[model samples]
Target: MKKTLLAAAALAFTAGLAHAGDTVRMGTEGKYPPYNFINDKGQVDGFERELGDKLCAMESLTCTWTTNDWDSIIPNLLSGNYDTIMAGMSITDERKKTIDFTQAYYPPAFSAYLGKDAGANIKGVVAAQVGTIQADYVAKSGATLLEFPTMDDTIAAVKNGEADAVFADKDALKPFSKAEGGDFVWAGQEVQLGEGIGVGLRKSDTALKDKLNDGIGKMKADGSLNVLLKKWFGDETPTF
Candidate 1:
């Protein structure tokens, strides 16, 4: 009963945003757990969701959440499907060519190779989500890179033996690796990647960008950002 109510509330909260004042529609890929995911209540929940909400509150802005497939997240944002992206999107020079980013919310973390064969060659065929930094890195790693539209498919490819291993954000693979028991293990050295995770907005949205930057400054000043970061990602999540 409680779950049902929460689900209803989640739907209503998100669906009613069009009627709210100063609503900022946030775009996210909801499949990445611990970052952003659809919770048991069918609501957007996780680190970014929490942080986005707090940031909106700080800026005195109303906000709503929408989930878009990772592959189309940026395009959809460009199409006005949402106001900004709160997905676990890294700030990158290549990506910056098309979209503007706010100050990084999370430091650039490392990517690792995961596989069933503990002894698999790091140079073997590897899988990564399409268009991600991991995919970009794999292309230059002398490994046969297999790209998938979503993180789930990348992991599925390794489990189904289509790829020798999967490379992605270390933190993203943590829960799955822990839950899979001894099935999957880290197979190679983790490579540091990207500048950090940041909120993506259209390049022309300088007003909104400045507002968000100010809100981020406030969070950092009062230490709420670090508090939420640790609450979701634990003590090791870098804070500055």
Candidate 2:
């Protein structure tokens, strides 16, 4: 839910609805592990990839996937580069002002601190991915914020001692913290942000948005969404 200047043509395009059965393009940042990431085969693979496919099948929509850098994700959608954003985007009022969202597919999860240090230095330098909720939090917080273009860079900042800690979605950082022989550790209390993760769409694609919402509802009702959540995030991660 970040970045980009909307062109006038893009704003005008948002007034038109997409035709049914048109090929739907699913946009993602294929760098965030467990959410959307490029697999060994150089194809998008992750929880969202699986989830999006299921939703598409349920809705009977022809779907395709594409990757974009996180910073321009929303703008690309508004400009019609993609039909939906399946990136790990949260539902927030600030983001809602720019684009509409389908109902949440993932539940609200905590953002946590990771570092070599034992506890977080709240007022010290903290690293977060640029244009993320965590970055916005550190900016408003008393801490000095160190922004990076990617999630991996934020962890690198902590590793290289540029920041006291990296704050990010706890699930996104779990593999690092629990890695064998890794030095990173959970540094502080987990902070919750946003409502939950959802599929982002242009305000004009009300039809697609409705189809996605209905498919998500079906998943939730049948417990299939929870299965995906557990498969990616472990049972300890909350379910719908």
Candidate 3:
């Protein structure tokens, strides 16, 4: 879900290896809701938090969570600030070249345009979170792309008429579209981008990657992943 402009810089930093029984640090953006966000008590709380905790428990690994800005989430992991990225990040070929990913925990989600004008699709000024796949798509679609550091900023741009529309995950935009006294509406045909969301790790952390994959596989086999998806995203969301 990010651009690779800092890939080389990230690659330059090596992960400080962690051994078994050590507390594996999980990094997240703590902004994207349903996936991750800071709760009323100012602690990490959301679907990813619950899922990550369960995964760690099942794997017999001690884990701790930390929050980072979305744009630098991957770089910090490579720099040894965190062992894994549990932010709502999509797995993409462009990203895979920079970091290793466990099997997807969330399936590919559709990107939608949120605005007051229903006819607006890819045209006019479009707002997107900086370095995200939605931003990349808008940049390539010949639309005027306004990049913001956070998802909230993108929505603000649309609300304030700074942009014609905001392109983001449909799930991310759903609340605004249905918000009481708000006029937000879907402005485009939904488009699917990237593979899916997953746990991002440094390429050298193969053991950690394998362990996460194994746990994810069990979750899928037991239908627990589906339960979590529906709990956060509603029954309409797809399952494995």
Assess the local accuracy of residue 138 in candidate 1 as a C-alpha lDDT between 0 and 100: 96
- TM-score for each predicted model, relative to the true structure: 0.88, 0.92, 0.91
Instruction: Please state every model's RMSD to the true fold in angstroms.
Output: 9.1, 4.0, 4.9
- Which 10 consecutive positions of candidate 3 have the poorest summed lDDT? 11-20
Give the per-residue lDDT digits (tens) of candidate 2, residues 1-240: 133345565555553433345678899999898999999999999999999999998988888999999999999888778889998998999999999999999998899998886765857999999889989998998899999988999989988889999999999998778463567888878899999999999887888889999999999999999999999999888899
* lDDT by residue for model 3 (1-240), tens: 255756655554445454345578999999998789999999999999999999999988899989999888887887788899998899999999999899999999899998976876558899999989999999999999999999999989988889999999988778778453456888878999989999999888888888899999999999999999999989999789
User: What is the overall TM-score of model 3 with all chains considered together?
Assistant: 0.91
Off by over 4 Å in 1: 1-21, 178-182
Candidate-wise lDDT, in order: 0.85, 0.88, 0.87
How far is 152's C-alpha from truth in model 1 (Å)? 1.2
Better of 1 and 3 by TM-score: 3
TM-score for predicted model 2 compared with the true structure: 0.92
Best by lDDT: 2
Q: Report the candidate with higher lDDT, 1 versus 3.
A: 3
lDDT of 1 by residue, 1-240 (tens): 999999866754454443246788988999987899998999999999998988888888888899999999988877667889998899999999999999988887878888886686668889999989999999998999999998889889888999999999988887657444636888889888999999998776776788889998888889988898888877887776
What does the lDDT read for residue 230 in candidate 3? 95
Error of 1 at 87 (Å): 0.8
Model 1, position 119: C-alpha lDDT score: 81
Check candidate 3 and list the clashing pairs.
none
